[model samples]
Target: PGLEVSMTMLAVDALLDEVAENRAHIGLAYNPPPHARIAYRASSAQPVVLLLRKDHPLAKRGGPASLNDLQAYPLALMPSTFGIGHVVSMAQVAANVSIRPTLVTNSLSALKRFVTAENFMTLVGEFAAYRELGSEELTTVAVAHPLFESAQARVLVKADRPLAAGPLELLKWIEERMPMFAPVKRPARRKPIR
Candidate 1:
């Protein structure tokens, strides 16, 4: 069969649910539920970074600000349903300081647009803001805290089905390019029931 890929965006729970239902063949996500078989590919030490406009005060003062330092400014945050939200929540508890963002939205584009024009900030994975960061439209400072030390990213495939040659090859190519800090063992293939 000629190879074609379909992509859709969903929150972690919904994404895994679709995978479990065999509605999707592959997914890229962080800390997906363990019930789904996962091929651990790479880890990122700074999964969450504070994103600010290039000339924002914090951006001007900084190289990796602590959560307390971030608390001094207004924030724009994703709702708790997204993975980044959960990470920030954990960091919040660990730091014992409440973060009350001036704006909260699930749309990354909304956060991107708002932060560029306002004195607000938000947290996102480096990949999410890769282009903006490269263009100097935004500056990212890692949240220097133990709770946000590192996060692993993995590829998920359904265990009930054997991966076809095309998809398998694509997966391998992705693994090769991933920013894996160190080698991680691939998930074992599930044996077909006799």
Candidate 2:
């Protein structure tokens, strides 16, 4: 496809509205609303993790932590306006505790800076933070709470409109690249003697 890619970040409602109105061809949202006018190309449920600096108090524990443990530290949570926050909020409610953030913003860079500068923690999808976690700049503790283990990321397109070359290509790319959240399978050993 020769078409150029133009990307814009829109709030979930606004993005859905645009897709419904045909103003945009496709939308990638964290938690797509259930609507008849949109088609789901691909979607996956990802585990939510608590991210913090390696030297943070929680990192030394070497085990998964519950939402109750997170309450002990200052947080730099995304506000409830974003879809990820909705998952976090549900976990907070189910755990019967509050996560009082030292800072609240939707920007990933801001969250990184906050956790780096101070002993702040944040919640993120394991896939979204994979690279950083691998780099050792941050370490994750599993949320291990039922309410949060089901958050999903979605790829949506207009139901009525046939996808053009560019949009179709993008849709296929996304569907193929959706990360496999399960362990990789290894080949079985062959018998050495007959």
Highest lDDT: give the candidate number: 2
Q: List the residue pairs that clash in candidate 2.
A: none
Please provide, for model 1 over 55-117, each residue's C-alpha lDDT reduced to its tens digit, 9 standing for 90 to 100. 888788867888877678888888876677777777778777887788899789999988888
With candidate 2 superimposed using the best TM-score fit, by how many Å does residue 82's alpha carbon deviate from the native? 1.1
TM for every model, in the order presented, reads 0.79, 0.83
lDDT of 2 at 191: 84
Candidate 1: which stretches are off by over 4 Å? 31-46, 159-161, 178-194
Best by TM-score: 2
RMSD of each: 9.0, 3.2
lDDT of each: 0.74, 0.78
The reply for model 2, stretches above 4 Å from the true place, is 178-194
Error of 1 at 74 (Å): 1.9
